[model samples]
Target: MTTGNSGSPISRYTKDRKVGEGTYAVVYLGKQVNNDRKIAIKEIKTGLFKDGLDMSAIREVKYLQELHHINVIELIDVFTAHNTNNLNLVLEFLPGDLEVLIKNTSVVFKPSDIKSWLLMTLRGIHHCHRNFILHRDLKPNNLLLSPTGELKIADFGLARAMGNPNEDLTSNVVTRWYRAPELLFGAKHYVEAVDMWSIGIIFAELMLRTPYLPGKDDLDQVDVTFRALGTPTEQNWPNVSNLPLYNALKVYPPPSRQELRNRFSAATDTALNLLCSLTELNPGKRCTSTQALLHEYFTESPAPTLPSELPKNDVAGGDSDDDEPENKRRKV
Candidate 1:
């Protein structure tokens, strides 16, 4: 794939403007000359590290190259510009993300609209899990919306193959807000439920239009989680006592599911049931992505709205086609 010796993939597109910037990379809105399709180019900064490529970039490239699904972001191409100290990734340009949509108070998403986004998000995640990959980091911002309103999982930088039993993996992979209790308790050998927990939180955020557990820090995250969901007990989660940091977890009596359900009066009872399953404290019992997709909430009266007909918002990935204002650049 090393094209530095000859031709470069960078020549095929016309970069229109910068879309986003981050500590590791800069994103540009570009168009392929042959077909004029829009694309987002993420140029990874290499000068900060003595190594040639960032570890997250390596992980992203390795996994995305192996998996292809409609709900996941497409990695169009990869190459390094000869004159620049960067690794550029050409990707499908999305209009906006769920975060911007959720944060836009002026926009009111119906139950079906929320269901549609959640359905697509789960489908994308299910694809990742089916292929033995774990998306350790899952949050509203990482869920990008295509112009058609289809939700696509993006930012796989923290994603990786699942850890087998008896092997140790980092407990600190997910963002603080969405980190599961098992991860908070420092469980080394965990499963894909970690991501499911995050999905549950995202579900709650969709319903409330605010973060479910907005902890100020890791410790605060754990406290808010137990208060909002429930503290894991050995009875509820059999292996709770065995986790590395179990002793450190606060001892809060589990909150009633009904109390939590009352918070989302606008949602159907079935919706609450699905959220309950996804947010279950026990990693062993949390709803799998497939179960989520098959949940009654989807088949109930208000079926998930078709993506193209959902509410519109003006943000990156909000609009599906041309005439969308060129995406504005901002730091990720």
Candidate 2:
């Protein structure tokens, strides 16, 4: 085990307060003594650190090191404690993430606020696609809000670089709920459209202040999605029925447009229409992330707010104490 200057295995820069804990790692709020700057440190367990480190962690470090954008979380450094067997990843510590923000506040966002979030989210995802990187995970939790109210996409654990368009990459990725229909249908060969599906889900969630389609599992998720948007037929999603996992689930007739209009009562007509276009059940029919970026929702009057101008920490207000265990640091 290795420690920092403080001589403890994990070192004590600032006493850690638990922020978020996931299956393989726990994120901590810490500071570097030399500069006294706050940072988010993700510590992977020694036992779980496999032959090298996890591929997802390695991919995140490799891609973020070369990809820099205001809308994307910045990775500062990577180091190991003096005596510990685990690896430490240091990242810019943003005050809060969108998940906590949406949950804590009851404020109905102005259309402008919604557009700002949508635009920033697309800009960040667009940058990733331009670089040939796909952010497979893009739910509210992975989208962090800076103290300045700007949103930065974080948690690139499931991200991957695209290869030949015809090649089949990994199938077991993306969280179940935000997963695109192609992924749920076992289309190993996919493209950036997968990310666009998540963006559509996110857009609906932002408007509704809840998950757009909350399914209990993969099958249920598909059922919920098709139920809302209507099942894809040969005319709707041409190649969808040919997908690997495509099977005859009891087919229900498509729902009327009136049903959809009533379902998204809070969303604007333009926004609802765009959501329908982007969330097409067939990968071939789904809109690209870049196309969605150019949609009228972003071009309307009272345009989206520039990220730098957004209010910082408007979503959540909290602080961390230095006396807690390093592993327990909570994200602000």
lDDT score, candidate 2: 0.76
Q: Considering every candidate listed, which one attains the maximal TM-score?
A: 1
Q: Compared with the true structure, what per-residue lDDT tens digits does model 1 show for residues 1-332?
A: 22232355766776777766788888888776667788888888887778777888888888888879999999988888788857887888887778878888999888889888889889999999999999999999898878777888988898999766777899989999999989998988889999999999999999999998999998888899998877888888897888887776657887676777578878777888898999999989998999998888889978889988988676434234443443343244
lDDT of each: 0.83, 0.76
Cand. 2 TM to true fold: 0.86
**Residue by residue across 45-150, what tens digits does model 2's lDDT show?**
6676547677767877888887799899998777777677677778887776666556656555666877899888898999999999998988887888776777
Predicted candidate 1: what Cα RMSD to the true structure? 3.5
Clashes of each: 10, 20
TM-score (all chains, Cα) for each model = 0.92, 0.86
